[model samples]
Target: MSSTAQTADTTVTIVDGRVVTPDGVIDGRVEIGGDRITAVGDSDAETDTVIDANGQLVLPGLVDIHGDDIESHLYPRSGARMDTEMALAAADRANVAAGITTKFHAISFELDESADRSPELAATLTDAITDATDLLVDHRLHARCEVTQKRCVEAVIDVIDNDNTDLVSVMSHVPGKGQFRDIEAFRQYYENANDRTAAEAEEMIDERGSMSMATLRERVDRVVDRAHEAGVVTASHDDENPREVEQLADSGVDIAEYPITLETAQRATEIGMTTAMGAPNLVRGESQWGNLSTAAGIDAGVIDTLVADYHPPSLLAGVFVDTEEPLHERVKRATANPADAVGLSDRGRIKAGKRADLIVVDPDPTPTVTAAVVAGQPVYHADTTIEVSR
Candidate 1:
């Protein structure tokens, strides 16, 4: 992402919550000076504002590496479009309400002019998200490049050059590879997403399968190299095997976004790349698509981050699930790990001198965000009656 501009005279103190840290959760308070946390301990120092957290869970702001639910925001229904500015703002509110303070909006480039995802639409979405900064959260762009869509390479270059893209991941949804190994699943996805008949979907799948892997690899390498040159992070989407994982890591991929199998995730981690799994899979207790279970990967200690995937609530909910690690470690996977993978080291942890992006959640059996402080500003509070003394 980008650096948050430091401010002045915006000091705040949060007290009476279980403050989470790398060491563990502590019954303490935190101090914020301007946009950075000045202390994270038993400090009761006075400030411009004091937030009584009501003995809630004070955690680091969640950092989601990849989430495309905004696609529904931009295109909420079939063949319908909403105002981009309004949609972005609304998406931000939904994410923050779910305790996500940072998001990498996954936008794809499907250059067949399908109207759902195209070069033009991706560019429009980038501009819209960038312009809607009034929203109370940090927004970054993740350019998902479909190398098979060769026509969109120039547009991808355009976005990397002009748009505020934080990460770029290679994706190939061919029926026999990547996320569409099951031809039936692939057919259903194409038919539903593109309104194609079964025969037409099969025909398109066949066409995509017949494409030259060498050509796609060359184009993907170009995009990856270009992004790397720009100091932007790179990830590979839904790799199916260790060999593919090795190749992607060799291609300068810094993270593995949803490797499809246990072996792939393990190998990615072994090769020093952060492995991410969908939070929805962990929340649902299984992978509905018959891929690797997120909880299994976590149990094996192969996964390092959990993304919202499509649902914002899953990020917050996945933390409370029974993991072998403590609450702080679970929060780290959703916060510090993903942020570090995307080169955002400033706002992920609840440490002194870190940016003050934090959330107060009632850590009951069913958790909910009570308040969110972005850059030391209380932008969202669930119960306005609970006053924040100034």
Candidate 2:
């Protein structure tokens, strides 16, 4: 659905909802003048539009730091690729409908996985992300560099120099390491994902060039330095152990995405690096690749953010997973924590003077995003049941 357009002088108010502010919860209203929240309290001002929340939750829109939903959109079927702009447009609508206002599309720069992930296409997609304008939600690029490949590292550095990426991550998906701790699991995963045989997957793995720790560190340092120079946040992906986390932390990485174990996550947290877990893992109660469980990470207090790794809907579902934590705390895992982690201070909280990126949720039968408003525009309304006075 198309968002309701707004003028600079337009004033929209979300009324009678339980607003989840940074300080605490308030059973009041939120006033949005233009693209910023002008006030957030019981006292309301005259407005051009009114969205009656009907005592539901008025929450800060989710800030998804690392989401790979675009990959599936780009490659919907085997040997089939969709138009880049069209795929991005679809992903944008899907994310906003899932209550995600800010999304960092994880674009992989790999040597030879799928044709869509090649260095050339990666560069093209990076530029596309930077140039796209007709999107529903706030879109940003998270360039995921396969550090094992020198070509991938160089491509990521080029994008960094061009100022195309908002967040950069260094990862090595070599078999028997990081995400693929077991060689058999790696082969199985590749075979299933690509619809290839075990021999083909093994051949693909064997064709990869091995890089030493020193070389890998050098490459990572290059990307990290370039990203820092460009004022972009850097992250380490699929950390396998505490030592790896410490090493990445030493390299000035600000976030660790999807640490493979609890020890790794704890080390990241202790070192003051933000730790993120997949929302699908949390909602499913286990990792798809048999890595650290999101519930386990939350239990250990190591998980700071929930990302829509491959499932946009899981972000909302993961927030309400049966836990001892309060509703606000769970919401923060998907909102404020991620925004703060990525240095996005303008949004993520339902407070005065912040960006008017908000989601209306109903939590009685199940947690559902009834409506989403981004930059003072009504992006998506689930049904006509929501009352909006124009």
Candidate 3:
């Protein structure tokens, strides 16, 4: 079955789509040749294939800098490990269906039960990610470094030195700060994982808290240096205040992943940092942890990128958010801005000589994805019929 609506040179053309470019959303057509966008304009040029977007939004494919939805594919219902290849293949299908062409599986080198991103699973997943052949979109590894675990520095350095990590972000998950501020909140995370009882979780949290990453700054420096030496972009995670943001800048961190408060986010942006937020947080209208809203971050010009984070589909959903920002700017936050944040300049925007990564969005009331193209090839076409409104 063809994923495309119509078939024509060896080229593909999408016409009558409200294409979102950096300038603005314009009624235009885009032509693709090989793996790149050949042209985007008012050209009426004939091509081998033509896809009529039917006046729906034609946008650059969502570039997700951090997402771990793939974790579910690994441990479907909790218990033994499945074939890693099978898991990644299934995850990539879901990724393209969500209109995300550039996906960074934020595999953590941390210890956690709820997420399979634990120490034991890191190598297995990293190997699967590196060698997966059935992926429909561009896949990269966003190595989440648990800085407090001094034992894992050599392992992380080895991967970065081998060029396996495309991006690295230093994380400190101590109990008293960032995500686990409240001791009860920390205890609940462990209790819900069902690995430890509340009392056991509390004990573990206290142990980890005493040895926070603040005390391991030297190890953080070493890991950051190794990542930078390998040309992997480094980011700081869960910034809490202006001082932390400033310190991250002084340490040469390329991006600030998620700031806990509005003041922190604003400070990060002020220091010439790329402030990113979760697309899920934006689409859901709030953060799960009751932190600063990504919408508010956007309004204040603090959010430079919106990553898929834990949810893949939220990237596209965030586009239809009712914001005062122009559609083009909002779209860029998910697409071009993230691509650039990760030092990728080849495949974000719709222009001649750029990668043909795009999503045709059905802009009807529901605003679902209709089709997705990656590297000039259609990868996903929605099976549901798009409903028309009166």
Candidate 4:
């Protein structure tokens, strides 16, 4: 067969699967042609490849709205770094195995000379991500700009102007306030994760004392204006108060990431900004950093999307642990809700005319991802019994 014919005729029909759609679950066969879902029903469509799901749950592949943990693979710890390309490939495989088809890697840029915010470093990492996309599922950059880092703002702006930046979040990490207002908590984090002595950690916090509130507001507004003008969505990170939420909303920020208080999260939702809660928070039953409880936010109807955050597996696990509603309802929070919030209207649900980005999961008393497909092509499969011929 010709290459195009081979690809087109390589129809993948998933049979006897409990398909999870935006609406609900149903026993059906999903027929995929090339890169789009041609049909999603029990129509007995003939296909060259068939997945015998055996009543497993087939749902949309996860769209992780924010994931900074990829950086962990590149720079595992302070002063230690790995090959960016190698780190990206490993991260891609890990995410795919966890059923994440689209991932937005959040790369933080801090302008402090003492920090590792090298312009060359950011460009190199961005280039690595762009080059690795061919071998990976959909990958995009979400630049987390520290608004207080005035020295490096120009460099970050240059990267954003490169047309590769898809998302930009305005963040200000001023110690003794906001996300790190509690000095003791900050010390503990640095001591545990960075292997710093308690004295060293305390010194770091004291050195980076809080940014001026007026300056923070101006920086946020400036970045938001530039990002929105470039067609990139803007997000507010670690908002701790209703006023912070209001400021972000006033600036037309599209998303509020990891709001630290229930009031702020509710205010974000009320003002029509999408609220993104970390999946790790849901899986742990609370935020590790003592931010707003994800379960509480979900119950309050303030959470719109679930991000992988620091753990790729948490995205899937969150769907199961979030028990405030039916399982299917919780699943939508991670899948369709995230896709909708990010303006990706195509592949959030299993339906004809949409991109066939989906996963077959074995679910009984527990859930396990068995196969993952992106754009109608099998990218990950746990069942070796099923053979394929090209």
Candidate 5:
């Protein structure tokens, strides 16, 4: 990714683009004075730099509330680990290149089944993210706690108390429920991914799935209460049914992420919780694990945000997929909707007096991000250089 810095006195203007604002799309210019957008529409001042969008769509930089791309960076190959700072620096560039200005790196605090998701690594990464100051994209933490695991809950609570997490999502990944409703499927996943025999996989699943409903509720309430006290947003993952989602809502969960069925998503919306689906589900037109498709959720009007999940590129690519929804609304799924969902009101919409986090998309030429500006600085530019004016 290309990076450039601008002085505080510099004025950057993006001209000749179809700017996607909160109200609708408009043919105009966006002027950035310092780190915030100073004007949207015509500008009469001579600028220090100009990004000629050339009729492309100028959109708000994506606010991805949940993306686990950091895990992939740390463990590119099985049993291989990279330095924490190196991985974070790489993830920052990858996200900014994909038009994600603000990224919440989803780190798992789970029972130590996988080395990458161990609580030890989670704490190390939380500290690394907290210390990093030279990242191009705005990076934050989304602590995902596996509710069935007491150790995981404790790790998440510790992070909340220390003020390290921006968002917390509680989930139960026990076999025969939630994401792995089919016990055999869960067994096969372990056998294939973990090099475990079928019998060993089943034994492990049974051991992990033995938590009682009362214990699960107690854990969820504990995490939510701690998160609320810290003023952090909370979410429930892989909600499977209306009753399950209702329980989460009643317990003060603010968002329902990746509900497994259309009915579950509808219930989440009905109960006034922000609903999110994976952008990969929308881009690929289906879920890998046979969950509810993002398109179906959008059609039902149950999904309020589209997150990067595992694939950062999918966030931008998913917006251009063929859908009946207007372009502006589709854009909101990646931008305004997620920003609002996470209680981030400073960015995610292209307007005056907001953070100048913006991207220029050339839609006809395969949805390329030609330029990305974060905090009023040109952080990334594609190989096809955009025209500049003095």
Candidate 6:
């Protein structure tokens, strides 16, 4: 469908299914006009198309605050790769199928000479996001700045300044501490992922270990200052302690990504920073790297939003399995909470004048997406019997 065609609408009625509106689910019809929801009521309204929701649960499309696995598609392995455009297209389709309407691809800028941190790779991914915006679901760039790789900070800042970057995270991945506080555990990560010998991994760590906390603080302050000035939301990655949270709060960081402990997570909340925990962590029952589990953080009232850090589909799955308190309460972590954290006040909730970004999922606890709409456009419609307006 042409972009203009998708945006042109007066009233498209969605009837029957359990409508998960901002207030709560109600059996009713939703009317859409252009990109906004015009009305939602029991009375039938004249419209261009009618979607029989039937046994589905109509809910807001996911607002994914952080997703970095797209890089694996752009550069499949350490060396092997695919075209940037192809990777982005495939990622967009996958995100839509998983019921994500808004995706922030976390592209890292590391100073290391590894192929993953190349400026060329970052630029290509950024360009692909821009080109595919019309053809796919909403896609935005989230720059993950590795403070240890201070040299690449300026290059990433250029991308943010160019206005395509949406979120910037200041991270310090120094081997001996912080996220990987135990040096031996850090060696294990390199050994497992890269198949490098322990000795070789240690050598790499030594060569890359010159960055100190003092230098990291200085560099991160500068990057955060610049990103905030550019109107981009800033985050601190893998914080493990209250001190780290305090430091980030001092720098005006808006979000805290993956706090490593309950103490840090709680500190983030006390300081008014939105804490983002990985959806995968909640689904997997634990953090893969032994960090504080999202469930634990949520129980502590520290988690504000859930992001699909590695697995894109975890966002939907998490909504079903987040068995902490109540299902309705947990749903907010994946939906409205993340939207508010990212300052996207328009698309997260289903209400009049809000963008029509929504998904149709089976009412089952662990549901599969039946259809997805972005800006009133059907991005992924699976009902073969019901014809989608192209």
Give the clashing residue pairs of candidate 6, or none: none
RMSD of 6: 2.4
Q: Candidate 2 or 3, higher lDDT? A: 2
Ranking by lDDT: 5, 2, 1, 3, 6, 4
Residue 271 lDDT in candidate 2: 92
Find the 10 residues in a row with the least total lDDT in model 2: 1-10
Which runs in model 6 stand beyond 4 Å of their true positions? 1-5, 111-115, 197-200, 322-324, 363-365, 384-390
lDDT tens readout by residue for model 1, 295-318: 999999999999999899999999
Please write out the lDDT profile of model 3 over residues 163-205, one tens digit for every residue: 7878888888778778777767777877786566777787778
Judge candidate 5 at residue 24 and give its lDDT.
Answer: 85
TM-score of 3: 0.93
Which parts of model 3 have CA positions greater than 4 angstroms off?
A: 1-9, 113-115, 212-214, 383-390
Against the hidden true structure, what lDDT does model 6 obtain? 0.79
Off by over 4 Å in 1: 1-7, 112-115, 384-386
Segments in model 2 whose C-alpha atoms lie over 4 Å from true places? 1-6, 113-115
Which has the greatest lDDT? 5
Give the whole-model CA lDDT for all candidates, comma-separated: 0.86, 0.87, 0.81, 0.79, 0.89, 0.79
TM-score of each candidate? Answer: 0.96, 0.95, 0.93, 0.92, 0.96, 0.93
Off by over 4 Å in 5: 1-7
Q: Which stretches of candidate 4 lie over 4 Å from their true place?
A: 1-10, 111-119, 197-203, 364-366, 384-390
lDDT of 6 by residue, 1-390 (tens): 112136464557677767777667777877788888888767666777777777577888898989987977876887677887788778888888898888888887764434456665677777777656355678888888877765667777888788878789888776877678888777887777766777878876886587667888888899888988889899989998999899889989999999999999999999899999999999899988788998898877888999988788899888888465665567678788888888888878778898888788874656688887788866677866434442
- What tens-digit string does per-residue lDDT give for candidate 2 at 121-194? 78877877888777888889899998888888889999888878889999987887888888777788778866
lDDT of 4 by residue, 1-390 (tens): 000112654688888888987677888889898888999877876777777777778898888989977767877766678888788888888888888888888877764323345556766777777656355478878888877767556656776787778788888776766677787776776667667677777766765665577877887888888888888888989988989889788988999999999998998988899999999898889888777889999988888899999899889888888465876788877788888876778877888989888888765455677888788787778866433333
Which pairs of residues clash in candidate 2, taking residues 3 or more apart in a chain or in different chains?
none
